[model samples]
Target: MQVQKFGIEALDNMLGGGLRSGRPYIISGNSGTGKTVLALRFLYEGLKMGEKCLYIATDKPPHSTITSISDSFGWDLLSLNVMDAVPTPSLYSTVYPVRDVTAKGEIREISEMSKNVEKGELTMESIILKLELEYKEKFYHRVVVDSFTTLKRFGVEEERRNPVMAKFFRFFVEKGSTVVLTVEGNIQKIRPELILSSGAIHLKREVQDMEEKRKIAVLKMRGSFFDPIEREFIIDKNGISIRKVKSK
Candidate 1:
C-alpha cells in the first residue's frame, strides 16, 4: 500500500508515515466531533501537493460547506473539485405533501426521500461516472464523502442499502482515489461492519467543562499496520492534530 501524508506530524508518525493511498476509509464520530474538519484537512493537503481532490457531500450544499471551511481554515476551496447531491426541499415536496401531514410524518417521509437521493436515484452514480471519465488521467488523488449516515433514512434493511454503498465504494476504488467517509456515531443501524467492510477509522469527541476534545482509533485497515489505541485530537485554525493518549 502506498502511504500518503495525513498532515499531522505526530499522527503521521503513528501511522509509520501516513494513510495508505488509494483506499476507502471511514471517519466516524458524533456531531461536533470535528470529523468534517479532519476529512477536509486531509483533502486540502492533497490539493496543496497538486493532487486533484473530490468532495462528495450528502448532508449540506457543497459550496456552502466548502466556503465555511475555507473561511475557517484558510484553504483555497476553489482549487478542489466538489460534487454534491443532497436532498432538496423541492425534491421532497415532489415526493410527499408536507403541509397536510403531521410534523413527525413529514419528517419521516422527507427522510426516506433523502435516502433515495443518496442511493443514486438522484443520479449520484451518473454524476460520479461522468467525473471519472473526465478525471481518469488527471490523477485525482483524494475523495471525501461528508457523511454516510444519511443513507439510513432509506430504511435499515441492509439488503436495500449495502448494495448502493458498495457500488459507491467500488467506483472510488476503480478511480484509484484515496477516500474518507464520515458517519455519525449515534446512528448505528447502518452498521460500520457493513459500510466499512473495506476499512475504517473511528473518531469520538467529548466535552469536558465546555472544552472540546477528540479521540481517534482505527477500527480496521485492510493491508496496513496502524495504532489501534484511541488518542486525543484537536481542531484548530490550521487543521486537525492528534496526540497519543498517555496511559494513567
Candidate 2:
C-alpha cells in the first residue's frame, strides 16, 4: 500500500514508514496536546513532497491564522491553499468549535450551533459542498480539517451531525486523498466517523517531573503494521519532534 509520511521521522518510523494513502485518520486529543500542530506538520509534509494540499480552518481565524503559526515555527508553508470556514458569530448564526484551551490553561468560549444561519454564512452542508466542488476541479492529495470537535459544533443536534460526517468521510475516501482530522476528546467515544476512518492516532499528555509531556500512540491503522507503544514528543518553535520510548 502506498503511504504518505507525516514527515516527523520518528513518527513515520513508528507507523511503518507512513500512513496509508486514500484514507482518513483522526488525530485525537484534548486541548494543548499538539493536535493542530501535528495536522499542520502533516500538510507541510505534503507540500514538501510537491503534492497539492488543502487546509480547512474550522477552528482558527483564517489563512493568516495558519500563516502566523507556521511563521513562528519557521515552517515555510505560505504557499498552502487554505479556506476559512469559521463562521462569524451572530445571534442566529454562531460559529462551530466547541471550545479552545490554551497551553497555559486559559479557556475560550465557543458558540452554539445556529438555529437559523444568516445570509452569506457557512453551514455544515455548505462546507461539504464547497470541498466536493473544489476537489472535482483539482483533487488535493493531502487535506486537513483542523479539528472535528469544531465540526461537531456544526449541526443543532447530534443526530443531524453524525450521518453527515459519515457521508463526508465516504466522499473524502473516494477522492483518494490522505486526510487528517483532529478531535478534542477521547478516541473511544461512539463517534460514527471513527467507524469509517482508515486509522486513528492519539496524542496523550501527562504532567510529570514538574512539566508536561506528550505520548503519541497509534490506536488503529487499517493497512499497516504500526507500533502500538506510545512514544514521547516535544513541541517547540521548530515544530513537533518525536522519540520512541525505550522498552523496559
The best candidate by lDDT is 2
lDDT by residue for model 1 over 29-91, one digit each (tens)?
778877888788888888778887777666776666777788887877567765444655422
The candidate maximizing TM-score is 2
lDDT of 2: 0.73
lDDT of 1: 0.65
The stretch of ten residues in a row with the least summed lDDT in candidate 1 is 93-102
Please list the residue runs of candidate 1 whose C-alpha ends up more than 4 Å from where it truly belongs after superposition: 89-133, 136-139, 151-158, 186-197, 207-212
RMSD of each: 8.7, 7.9
- TM-score for each of the candidates: 0.75, 0.83
How well is each residue in 1-248 modelled by candidate 2, as lDDT tens digits? 78999888888888888888988998888888888888888988888999988877777665455656677788767567765566653221112221111101221112222336554345566566666656656788988888667876765366677677777777778899888988888766736656778888889899889988888998888877888888889988878898757778
Q: Candidate 2: lDDT of 120?
A: 36
